[model samples]
Target: MTYSKLNISTPSLIINKNNLLSNINKMNNFSKKNKINIRPHSKSHKMIKIAKTQLKYGACGICVATLYEAEKMVENKIKGVLLTTPITNIKDKVRLKNLFKLSDSFMIVIDNIYSINFLSNIVKPLRKKINVLVDCDIMYIGKNKISRTGARSIKEIISLAKIINQNKYMNFRGITAYAGDIQHINNYNKRSNEAKVRYNYLKNIIISLKNNNLDPEIISGGGTGSHELDAKSKLFTELQPGSYIFNDVEYNNVSIYKSNNKHFSPALIIGTSVISRINKKQYVVDAGLKAISADSNLMPLPIEPTPIGTKYSFLGDEHGKITLPKSSKIELSLGDKVYIQPAHCDPTINLYDKCLILDENKSIKTWNIDARGYG
Candidate 1:
């Protein structure tokens, strides 16, 4: 388990186990304080170990982005999977039925009457009731047009719920309005207010539904960027915060869950090495576009502080150029280990076969990214 004994040739991802467990506990405590259930999104880690940890910390269930993900999670015996995406295809419907045989509770989101009708027909034959959530998009489609939240509009959502209510094969769970676009709103007040607007919109819909004698048991939404805001708003009865377990560079920039005691540390890292040193002001790592994901605005930086004027730039397919300083104290020789904080943890982890679970001392234990290749 020591660093020297560990294999370092292949591109590997490391997860700080302690930091991960701590984040889970913190989120669980937050949910408890606010009287809400924690149904963390599984898309962030997509690993059985991490999903189990979330459940250990009092998660009511795990949320996934697709049926493929739910199938994999059920294979690992992770119960209570809530599929955040709509189930459309017939093949996927078969897979969902298989999952239902294994899991105690399952949920999926639908945005249209077609999906509802399709699910109803599929589930009716099996004589089973499938839980359904209405997906609402809060972002404008383009140029100030308020885009339809998955169910298209409030009226459509109510209609869909009524259809579900009428169908004995389908169960109307609640609405799932995700304001995903506002997760990284840099301005604190602006992000909070914007999220509030979306929350109020859904809340009003819920009120209208109740007025029509339909009560929703769950009002789920919010991501890592706005978990606290969603929790405090008293809008959602349960929160599905995913990235909070492994705060990445994108989330760290605008996170409101700060701690004076101990913050949620970045549990994931890409361990690369100095494969080639080009010059005094530039070097190259073994990782590049193929090794890590750089969709979060920038490339990875060295874990420790680099010298002044140092910069790391993506170079082609398999190289990363590091601009060194003139008076740099860093002696990054050939074969020196470089820990890279990934720009996006989810996709970055997906590229690897497994993740190295490390303790505080950097000792490693391997955990298979069991759901990595599910898609």
Candidate 2:
């Protein structure tokens, strides 16, 4: 249906069904053609419907960022759930024991020998093996001072893999290294080149692992921004790109979007209302720091129903201001609604408990953001 048909509260999270499905199909089509598996990251949507939809579109399974996310996926009967982060807490280790027992296809990523030994102790009593992968640090080391997780070097990753293989309670499934830092690089050539560098590094690691008889069956990494070159590289057995389903402003700037007859579009958005107006050039909407997330210090852009060249910024915790150009003659009255494209998709989606999903047949449905919070 249309935007006006979405009858919901102010600053509500909205999903365009056609756009969402198109994105899923596009990613799936690319992976299938390239002969690689796609494991869509559930952290972006964190809902049952979206996960199931991805599986329906031929996704191998789902990738979760937290233990809670894995629990929810297994609890709902979603199989082949891969925990991509190296969880450290003892309580979560305990949680993993239960979660593993529920789904034999469950797996986790680890980068340390201590984590392996600790998990081995936890899983010893279960009488079952917990599957795991080695998180490799593929992010550019010299590019930034702050570091991302994974084994810092190939030697360390091999050592971690060996420990996992030796541990009776753990099964060494594969290696995972997400270049998250490069996902939003504005230049396609630079992003592709950097990803290739990481790919070559990983290839050498695989050779080393094979030499040690620790050959991994799975090599998982890649994001939405580098999907085009990622599938072509023929390195990653399965790709995990979360934000493709919901094209946010950050992705809009960095990602090399294909605008053919079929492609991904900005499906997830915030619908806000013009609560107050300062003049013809400026107005206040109900969404702000609370409604839209500012994780990368990125501001939301005004989607249609709002004019072009309109700017949006967080005014306060509960409000956002939108300013128009000086020459613009458009004047929005009070109570008028505006649909905005959020800057960051993942955390912005977590702010809401439910989203208003609009269908092509003018149907408005609400879906719970099942894995919405830290819990």
Candidate 3:
């Protein structure tokens, strides 16, 4: 089960199962204690094993960002799926209908009359009713007014809901408002306050719906960065927080989660080998931009922190330069393995064929990044 026995070379992403399970249990318990449903987003891990673990840990369902993602989850026997994004095309409609036939419960987001009509038409002939959630735009508008985040306007949401209320082929579920922009505000208080504003806006909308005789069964929203805030907000009944299971550097830097000194253990890393050393103070690893993602605005953290005077930089397509101080005692030799914590796990994982699930001692257990390249 160890890495050496697996017969794989370096430059592979390794996942720590122990750390992953710890995060999953923490989020699951948090949701349960607060009386909220945990629906961790599957777009982060994209591994069936991880999805199964979340369900076992008490997740009511799993959330996906795309139809392709949902298709992969269905293959893994994931029953309840909430597609956070809108689906409009005819091919997607047909595919969704087929998925509905296989899945126990599936819901999609719709913003306008066109998408609502399209979904209704597709589901009508099959004698099936597709569950729909109104995607509320929760963007901050600077005057304490929250605007539509991505989907249609409030008017559009009500209009679509009215259409679904009358349609036999569609079931109006609830509302999905994700304020992703406020997740990493750097200040916990500021972020929480801003999230509250967004939450209140959605709550007001739900109240309005109730006054009109519409009962929202699902008020779903939240991301990894705002899970704590959203859970206590009393506005969200179901939380869709991804990235909590395997957090990246960007999420780790947030202020709320960062305590006096402790932090969430990063569950993913890219194992690379030193391919060349230009000088006593400088070296290069086999991993480059293609191997690791840098969208989080930081280079991967070395498993063992680089020496006091060392730094890493992307050299080109397939190489990374590590600069070291001349007086540093540590010297990296050719073929020596160094683990790198990627800045962003999602895109970096897509670049890999599979993930090497490792235990405390770095033993490898094959876990396919099965949903990779779904886009």
**Mind sharing the TM-score for model 2?**
0.96
Better of 1 and 2 by TM-score: 2
Best by lDDT: 2
lDDT of 3 by residue, 1-375 (tens): 223333457778888788888889888778878899988889887888888989999999999987888888987789788888888777777788887777758888887777877887777778877788888888753244455444545566676677777888878888888887886676787887787777777777888778767778898998888877887778888988887777776766776453423445688878887899898777899989889886767666665545554566788889987777677888888877766778777888878879888887766688888887855
TM-score of 1: 0.92
lDDT for 76 in candidate 1 is 83
Residues 44-65 of candidate 1 have per-residue lDDT tens digits of 8888888998998899999998
Error of 3 at 287 (Å): 0.8
Question: Which stretch of 10 consecutive residues in model 1 shows the poorest summed lDDT?
Answer: 1-10
What ranking of all candidate models by lDDT puts the best one first? 2, 3, 1
What's the true lDDT of residue 199 in model 3? 74
| Candidate 1 accuracy as lDDT | 0.77
Tens-digit lDDT track of model 2 for 1-375: 447525678889999999999999999988888899999999999999999999999998899998888889999999889998888887776687888789999888888887787788778888998898999887745366336778988889889999889888888898987888778887777787777777888788889999999988998988888777777777789999899998888887774643312235899989999899987778999998899997767789997766788889889899999998666777888988888999999999999999988888858899999998775
Please, what is the TM-score per model?
A: 0.92, 0.96, 0.92
